[model samples]
Target: MSWDDPRPMSPHLQVYKLPITAKLSILHRGTGGALFLGLILMIAVLVSAASGPESWASMHSFLSGFFGQLIIFGFTFALYYHACNGVRHLFWDIGKGLDLENARKSGIAVLIASVVLTLLTWLIAAIV
Candidate 1:
């Protein structure tokens, strides 16, 4: 009646390798949580704008600082990454891109699209 069985356990994490899609899946969840936290910051910015010009300016100054810009950049990247991955998930829902090779290509495409879109958005913002 021992709980332990004679079956051998699977290899530990050290011996296992994760595929690109698996890595992206982990990143997708992490970015989702980051976006949730970023929403709080966005709300604070909006509230400051509603308070007064001085409050809005103070918030703007903080957002324009190096640390704030870095955080915003991270949030931007996360937003884009989550969006692209979401489209991929939608494809999965529609019974598409289910093959192993197709899944890998789609995962890579999502990553590239997210980075490209994030850079394109920032570039346009800087230009305007």
Candidate 2:
């Protein structure tokens, strides 16, 4: 086609809808990045504990606060999601759950498992 000629353009993201498996795949990548950040927070807690009582107390205080708890909750969810999705990927690697029906079911299972595991973790932590 000539440069001056009008060319057809692909659909924009706003005009296109992604399937559940595609959305879950994107979320899996995002949660991986969030887990990296969570590791940094974990290190900070460790360092604070090793430093002294004052440092430990400060870290504990922040961790006990609402915003800090919210971050921890999100981190917990990300951790479970990454793990669950990794297992799904392993199944795909083995040529299981690669079909449309199974793939969608696996995607939904990952989401449900992540939320349930996250809540269960928090519940157990509160109990102990």
Candidate 3:
């Protein structure tokens, strides 16, 4: 590597590119992390439920509240998004959809589809 090489270093974050794929990729990682945390909470819930009526009652009261419901909804969205995108990644790992155009399109599609699925799950939980 020449010390005086005048090759222009690409300005990474300075580039004014805010593509859908970029946003989705970032969100996917974020939601995946959220889901990991939510999983621990879920295990606690299940254990509490199995413990006794007292424990179940405490969990039930919290889960019945507005804030609890909101957190639950958010957690559900994270789980769905992570699961859906993980499947997409599996496809990529198998040498499918590696092209730039297809990857970007797929990322956008996964983001939209995950929101729709999340909403559907919430609706079902609310109604039934």
TM-score of 1: 0.88
TM-score of each: 0.88, 0.92, 0.78
Please give the range of 10 consecutive residues that has the lowest summed lDDT in model 2: 1-10
Superior by lDDT: candidate 1 or candidate 2: 1
Per-model C-alpha lDDT, please? Answer: 0.95, 0.95, 0.86
TM-score of 2: 0.92
Total colliding residue pairs, candidate 2: 0
Which candidate leads in TM-score?
Answer: 2
Residue 59 lDDT, candidate 2, scale 0-100? 97
Can you rank all candidates by lDDT, best first? 1, 2, 3
Give per-residue lDDT, candidate 1, residue 22.
89
Of candidate 3, the 10-residue stretch with the lowest lDDT total is 9-18
Pairs with steric clashes in candidate 3:
none
Candidate 3 segments whose C-alpha is farther than 4 A from its true place: 1-19
Candidate 1 lDDT tens digits, 10-116: 88779889889889999999999999989999999999999999999999999999999989999999999999999999999999999999999999999999999
Q: Whole-model lDDT for model 1 versus the true structure?
A: 0.95
Pick by TM-score: 1 or 3, better one = 1
The superposed Cα distance between candidate 3 and the true structure at residue 7, in angstroms, equals 7.5
Model 2 residue runs over 4 Å out of place are: 1-7
What does candidate 3's lDDT look like per residue over 1-128, in tens digits? Answer: 68698997666777867776677788888998888888888998999899999999999999889987888999988888888888888999999998889888888778788899989998897799
